[model samples]
Target: MPQRSSTFNPHDPVTLQRMQSARSIHSEIMGCQLRKKKVLELLPPFGAGKDYPPQPPDIETYIVEFDGADDPMHPQNWTVRKKLRVMTVLGFATFVVAWGSSIFSPAIFVISEVFHISTVTAILAISLYVLGFASGPLVWGPLSELYGRRPPTLISTFTSAVFHMGVARSDDLASIMICRFFAGFFGASCLAVVPASFADIFGNKTRGMAIAIFATCVFIGPLIAPVVGGFIVTSYLGWRWTAYLTSIMGFSSFALVVYFMDETYPPQVLVEKAQFLRRETDNWCILARQEQSKFELSDLLEHNISRPLKMLFTEPILFLITLYTAFIYGILYLLLEAYPIIFYEGYGMAFQISELPYLGVVVGQIFGGAMVVAFEPMTYKRIVANGGRPIPEIRLIPTMIGSMLFTIGMFWLTWSGAYHRHVHWIVPTISGIFTGMGLISIFLSALNYIVESYLMFAASAVAANTFLRSGFGAGFPLFAGAMFKNLGVQWAGTLIGCIALILVPVPVLFYLYGKRLRTMSNYAPT
Candidate 1:
């Protein structure tokens, strides 16, 4: 075997970054190693493929290529079925976290009455929990980079289950608020880590579908919560069961994660491999990133925290899409505020029966999943036909149509509410479905685009999306009731719809200018 030597400076983020970049070279060279067993192999040239355009030019200097591109330890070399199984476990973990966020929304009044707080303040249980969702990612995203994704994910998720149990048992307002926030904070791991895991496992060709499936599962969690939460509220068990049952579900998610998930982050896997090889062959030259870089907490924190923000500001494509996604996310959470008003206040339905309206959003999520199934392949085919280089803009095509549908659905709900007696309840309920589809379409597009554009930095880009959107998710509901109460349902919805309509230009601008935008950034592909 041939050996090479270079000065090792552990703790350099640039060197750490190059360690990650080496995996692509390793993956690209997979099968070629068989023919070159006795020769020095050149690094794999990147770009003009569904994989990212390539890491920074310097990454090739610090690392060894894998034995071949098909090396089984490399996640990209995993079978499709194995890749998806990891996604499934991660997706299920996500479902319970989101379920905890929204399931208790319908019971806010009950919680208020029990705790003797105002209904407005009671709504903070939901919003504060979402605030935790936003903030947790800021911490967890960096933690995952320091540790691998799995430890932080498992630890956070398991503790989130404990917090949910605390939420169930809380007798005072402060207790519930504190417990819910912690629960959201811990529960955020699945959201923060899993998409990055997806990117780690799949190449660009299939990442869209992976995100779509995980996102579909995520969308379903909140929408379906009202169905079960409503029954718990109306039943003798009362509102606390919403948290109690969700806590139990969180525990179940914990077990699924511990049993099924193995480390998928490529750099971590390589570190383990390097360790094993060193012990086996007594070859200290088998270097992985962890061995090459000294761990520096302050540098890690600064780089992880500031780099995403830096990329966020400099990259116009990321800014536009993330802002759009943040609004769409906020609106989705805002619906938790809107739905009970429409059904309970407007139609005078019982709590359990009123939840039937949320089924509309569930139906819309399904339709959105189907749209991805239908349209994603078309998008993929176009990328393939373009000689394998995927344009980040391809993600925006569905988003354009989604923006229009979202606007129409918002208007439909607004106008239909004024004539509820003249029109069947089904009319406005279907509006939820259309709006749900619009929401999901925009979500999937933006998420896939972020994954495509940022590539390795996806966790950070997504964290930025989560921060702004989750803030909106948290803040919007604080005012949701006020808007509907003061303006009435029709005009309040019009207020929202008009904003969405104005932002409709977001996708159009990106689609036309994405390439030009990428040109301005060192991060985005040309």
Candidate 2:
């Protein structure tokens, strides 16, 4: 047996407890006396109790190559001003992407006239932009993981802006359609990038509020675009000016991003820095062992590209929520399209006056946005109290109320219009306010919960949701007029309302069984 000190040194504590009874006494003695001593001496000297150097505490504390701050790649340590600027740039870019959905609302008649296309076909142009929104995120979501956010954002914004410029100068329907499609393709990049940007900028505790703010901006953009477009179109600025204005907004957003946006992708930044350090010092060991070895480009490509699609296909929570969201989004666009015909044709109103109905959408969004911000923290607290399992279903409270309001509003508006009741045009408009408010609340709550449930893959989850939603947004408007004409106003709205009603239980069910549901779900984060 080998003898050992019974007492431990506080400053240089023994790592191994017993060497002999541990079955490796001789080897341990050699290691401690010879190998360990040599290794300790080879390491830099540790501090004594007194006369300490004024070095950074982190430097002396951690044995890694650098403290977190020393790594310039960490986004958290960035200046507050710099972070805010990046957020602003992303927010503006998001606004541009969202604006595309409603910018053409006032220009529908103009589009019909210029293209000599039927009203339904012309409406598809609006749908196509949203379709681009739906699909763009999936492509961009994967690409960002592969290439980093900056490249995709830059390329998408620049290209989308250029397409809008082309739209402004387009001669015929073919050119305009081509420009719009390209614009949507580029515009979709922002949708993919914005939420990811939020994830990078805000901590988990504060992220929900930040996301709500982003959602507010996103929702507000579409609502306000129509109002702006109405004035632009009514002023004889021509529908092309709408494209021009949106292009200008996109360009300004691009410049802000170029100047302010710092790289938030840790892997990409570290990889780049590692390559630089390897070049400068020619030391392969400069980075931590975990990051020293580069991953295979093929593996990264496969994972990045395939993962979102895999999750989209496999995740039941993501799939169902996406379906519901798409239906909601479709109904929204359907309602937008319906407003023109419902209020103007059915009631006999002027074009500028007809655009006033959009006020309902705006007012509703304001109310919903406020409610989300106010109620979310309470819900979060309640869920925590119920155990750590916060179910996605609880979020349905707002959605259910909103959906019922949506249906009632639609029914009331339709019946009022059909009967030529005592109410002025404002009556239906007021009902529209209720519908818009309810729809936005439900849509936003569903989206927020999905994002939370799929935190690891938030962009991809949202992309899937956006795809379904945008598909509806694009397709619904095309049938709005025909549906109204064929089914009659009351029945058309009632049918859509009934469809919305079926989804009411979805949120409630999820709220109760969400933990179990998420447990069974493959795509949901554990």
What TM-score does each of the candidates earn?
A: 0.87, 0.80
lDDT per residue as tens, model 2, 185-282: 78888776677667655543455566766776767777778878888888868888999999998898888778878777544555566566766766
The number of clashing residue pairs in each candidate reads: 8, 5
**lDDT, model 1:** 0.79
Q: How does model 2 score by TM-score?
A: 0.80
Superposed on all Cα atoms, the candidates' RMSDs to the truth, in angstroms, are 10.2, 11.8
Candidate 1 runs further than 4 Å off: 1-20, 23-65
lDDT of 1 by residue, 87-174 (tens): 8889989889988899998789887787788988999999999999888887776566556788978998799999999988887889
Candidate 1 TM-score to native: 0.87
Give the lowest summed-lDDT range of ten residues in model 1.
Answer: 25-34
Q: List the residue pairs that clash in candidate 2.
A: 127-474, 326-469, 393-510, 393-511, 394-511
